[model samples]
Target: MVWGLRLFPRAGGVDELALDRALSAVDGPVRAAFALQLLEGLDESGVRELLAEAAVADPVGAMRRAARLGRPDRAGAQAMLRSGEFDPCTVQTRPSDLLRRRHRVRAAAVAAALCVVAGGLAVAVEQGARGGGEERSPAGVFAPVLDPAELMRTAAERWADTSRVDFTAWPARGGRTDDDGLLGRALRAWAEPSESVRVSTTPGTASVPPAEPPQLLFADEVDGAAVVLFHDSADRVVRYAEPLSGAGGAAIDFARTDDADVTTGAAVVVSRTADGARFLLAPWIAESTTRDLLAPDTPGRPLEVGPDGVTAEVPRPGAGGACETWPVLQLRSSERIVEKHAFLLTDLGELAPTHLTYMPKPGRGTPARQPREATGPDALVAWARTACSLRTLAGSGVRSVNNWAFAEQKLPEGGASADWVCTRADTWRGPGRVLVQFLAPAASPADPATVIADRDDTALCSKFGQHVLAGTHWRADSGRWYVLGAGSRAVTGIRATGEVRGAAGGPTLAVRAPRDADVELTASLREGGTLTAVH
Candidate 1:
């Protein structure tokens, strides 16, 4: 005689099938309450009063429904009610027969209260009903609440403890059971106490900067290994990094653990493959308990590659032993190409390393590419002459080159690492002066030359600069130039006066140019790579 089922004497007359069907039709909470009342041997009045407290409307009708369906065994009902471990408040709600009749409103309030009191049991029942019991958590148990600091500290200790033990004789590969057995044995060995391993805990308020509030720092700097854990306010190990160290003069390999979990944290282990190339070992932790606490293991998944390079899924433990997935970026490189490092771009735009190993296949043997020649002030001046030819300045009667000045400046794109050459040229037409200035990459030749130019009516004392009225600015890339300033006047024509040459100390065009003439210039780099112009 199971709970919720009626027990019958072995006389074949009872229609147990029909009775079971009727009992199954009742709501879980209602059925549970009814079972409890039957088991408790409540009288008619007591039953009715219990129903009202449970917010079950029409107590008589509910009982009649159950009776018409089947006779539930008192002992079985009592066992079922006890197995569920319902809270006292849930089993006995507020005493009010009047409220039971108006169950629509009262039941709603009672259901809310039951949800709070019953904890996971109520949730399991509701989910079980909806999902045919497939979605229910374990009966009579609530989700685990984790302490982040304790979890990290425990993890750090486990890591330190395991590294010192020697597992050199373990079999490398075997069947599933054998593999699991080997891993378990190895982990046990690692967990053994060792004199070489050391553990230290620091208060959150110590001089060390805190990563977040309510944190605890743990460091396991063993003889041959080191680990640092930063437990955040939520008690989750938010950050874990391996410190660089020297052992036997070998380069130190660093690894990072994924989000901390009770059972095991994902770690990227750096080790060399048999072929002498570096490879990363990302081991999935097996499910185990520590000090009677459950540490669930995470399932292994295929590693993914994205634009940011290799990505490993790190499990972030949430409240109640649940975990969220966080993808961490890793570095990638080819034997022929330079290794490129990647950083974890956090929400605040800060970059941190995922600290995983990457080994790309070696490329075919080929000669290394030569670096480009450095573009200097002379190269920029030469570019300017070709850009500002007499034909390009035709209408203004600009016959000769003028004063030139060059300076090294910073460009917008490359920051301080790359240099830009700023060149300025001064020309004049009698009472008017025209100034041309341009910025070009100083480390490499601008594929196509560009210039920023302005004109001023010297007679009116106007200064020709970047902000001149209708000043023209153009960008040249790959031997083509186009106006960048929309309102500026276009170059009407351009023709090269001579071979492009750098101007060191040249005659001022302002002293040699004709008066009352406006310059109209057009310029373009020709197909042969020479600067051509028409004016």
Candidate 2:
């Protein structure tokens, strides 16, 4: 009926389409609040309480936002409520009628029992006449045609001689392999996962199914739950898990793997087991160590890795908290590289684990010469923790991330200079993108950086790229206005001509110009080339 109203409606002159548009303009929580209050006829407090149960941060605020958008027609809603009215009390019944109905039900049950007994006797006599009658084993009567043991042996042999460090080479672990139902379910999930199944692949990893059946990686029990890990293809890692007691539906998850993961030397998939969270390490991982990225100087804590490449239960980070401690995994791969991975337990959603990799401006630096050295600059690590990069790019198949300080300019009226940084996320497939941030001078190390722009594909911060960062006015302490312009790192000097007469060298230019003037700026690069600004 509610959908009918939406499809064709003029309820007290309220256009349901317009009302829907207004509600859709708000966030999800706010939209939910509207549905509960208006359609479900819930009170404001009840709606707020339900929203709180759903983990909404500001349930009352959501309700307030819904109310402010204007309410629909109460009279029309009341009329709809009246339209479906029915009274149970209007029907009549008697004890005499109930007794007759009970008698009829009892007679039907006896007749069914008699018919079953006669049919069984006839079947027994027929079997006796044919040959020696024998009862079949009930346990094996409906066994599945596929053998779990045979399946495992075949999959294992397929990858025994392979040189790749993928799921095929990974040892099969998990105590639940004997459970044919669980194994079959996992295999079916791999071939054709349900639409509701959650899938997360890092930027460059493949998300599609393999051309053939996936190879088994692990089929053992982890902390009381049956977990089956496999690979859809060489580059795709898939995991399926369910309760050992068969109490809940199975959950299937997918992640991509590549040479970058191998070169970094270790990849991990964070899975939620029955007891807690467990880190599922790749086959090539020799050892797993973790440390608090928030406290970089702290000594690493080694986690015991089982023969099956599963780590003991690790503490799960609280979702949405101002990250108190960023957990960094130093997974030592068989190739002897300490791969750094940082996990963020964000409120956004479940994400496939991505490593914290650093790419220095090609010739500027290498990925840390020391085995114990951290991946990127200290400032970049700080930015990753405080800024929204991790939260935003968690599902972008980010193979690695590098923070580049593109340009820095001393504020015209400030005590310190502001840094313009571009954070590039190199995905698996090939091309990468960047996030541009205008980090104001920090009074302390704890100050958070602000994101100025996030460009999906741009060469604005790369080497040999030529583009002016378009000028913006900054007001001084004494109320004087100055126009500031910055260019790429290759830019050697900047000249402001019309309405602003100033020249400055080294990427940044500042001139005391009118706020609304038609300013013309030109940038000179080290390659003896000059280019005019275009915004």
Candidate 3:
């Protein structure tokens, strides 16, 4: 007989139900001893004190007897442990109510162990008094009658019609979920948050509740605090947690989602502990890995996925500031699309991962798709080192970013080619801006290149607009100076006036001039237009 359940309709009934039935058949002291230690997660001292108040003869003997009766198959036991059954919040009887029925049981004794205040509401169980209440009863009264399987099934059925991935498909993990008190509060806060519950939302995120019951995504202890993540709908991801310092009330944070988030998934910075920041990866992701952006060719390290998709701890971004190209996480979806995400420690304690978008070259048409891994090391390394790529443009509503080498000038003494590159960032809501930098070769791979002549928002770097860039830098090796100017590839020729007099054909111009020359440079575009350089 499979799992010894031939007596019931199903053979596989040797689960928490079977265990509960076995415990109920035992004496009251035995049942109380088992539930107090196993379900409440109380120490021997706490269990003994509560059992003593209930007038049990020997707490240790009762506990030993209870363990023997309650033991189930190994698999059943693990499932039972993960399920968080018979928690005080789920059961109908409060410790106060149970104490009232016992002659020797005191409210103080039970409250010290079972009663808890969460979100300004009591989490203790409360049930109606039984008839002939003075008589002793088995502690099976505290056992939960409802099974969690039905709830999971109901949630799945509710999400069946949605096009997005069902939230029920993801296993719930994280937080001190085994802690009945904390898990109960988290569940309650999501299902029926009261006026006293605190709520927060990121810009453009929705604060409304879902049409149906929200789905549980994560529940675990993080950074010494109880944290929970729930999906209100395909469009909203909500997080509820206790204050990290234990000084303030619990709060709910909201983040808006779109098709981009669904296809690429995300890895959120859930907590920052002594070890470093912890990440919670989206459940739909097939795999997650990270590589140092500064070292583009280095092998990427695979991050181990924990229960419910949480990742192993990672080092927080160093103190080098935005100049430092922090490591990037690459999340590969089931569809085989790999996305790159950048994370930064922000004042908004819990950090959300920022999605990186790639801008196509000017004539390449609209961005064909969302950003993915760069095609080559040069592109990846260039983006990784650009100050405008990750940090400065993260929250600026950026939809895409591109780094274009507008001009390549050979060093004054035939040293090497130095590139004048402009980074164009386009926002989702329409406006775009540009940052220009000059990159000179450096000695080591660790020091990829140095950026100079950095300028921002001074020139047009869009396909629909045309402009030119000109700047002068002194060369110590050549003992002379030169004026450099460049326009888009469409430029046919360039002319210089004012203190510097010279003319050069084609898209780039380099002419020997005095260091302080006030040069007025103009460019003729192949598309029939003359544009002046912005200093």
Global lDDT scores for all candidate models: 0.28, 0.57, 0.55
Please give each candidate's TM-score: 0.16, 0.59, 0.54
Give the best candidate by lDDT. Answer: 2
Order of the predicted models by TM-score, top scorer first: 2, 3, 1
What TM-score does prediction 1 earn? Answer: 0.16
Clash total of candidate 1: 24
- Candidate 2, residues 364-404, lDDT tens digits: the string is 33332211123445543454444444545544466555556
Best by TM-score: 2
- Scored against the true structure, residue 238 in model 1 reaches a CA lDDT of 24
Clashes of 3: 8
- On residues 1-535, what C-alpha lDDT tens digit does candidate 1 reach at each position? 4433343433212344443444554544446446646567666677767777777645654553333222336554344444423323333223335544577678788999988889878667777778854532221123112212122222322322343211111111112212222222222222231343222111121122223332223232222333322333332222222324543221211111223221112222222122211112112222111110011122223344222111333222121111122222222222122233221110101111112111111123432222111122333233323332221221221212232322222322233321122222222223343433434444423232333433333321122321111112223333333221111111122332222211111110011112222333223221212221110
The stretch of ten residues in a row with the least summed lDDT in candidate 1 is 287-296
- Writing each residue's lDDT as its tens digit, candidate 3 over 366-401 gives 322323334345555565556323443443344445
Instruction: Please estimate how well model 1 matches the true structure, expressed as its whole-model Cα lDDT.
Output: 0.28
How well does candidate 3 score on lDDT at residue 292? 65
Cα TM-score of candidate 3: 0.54
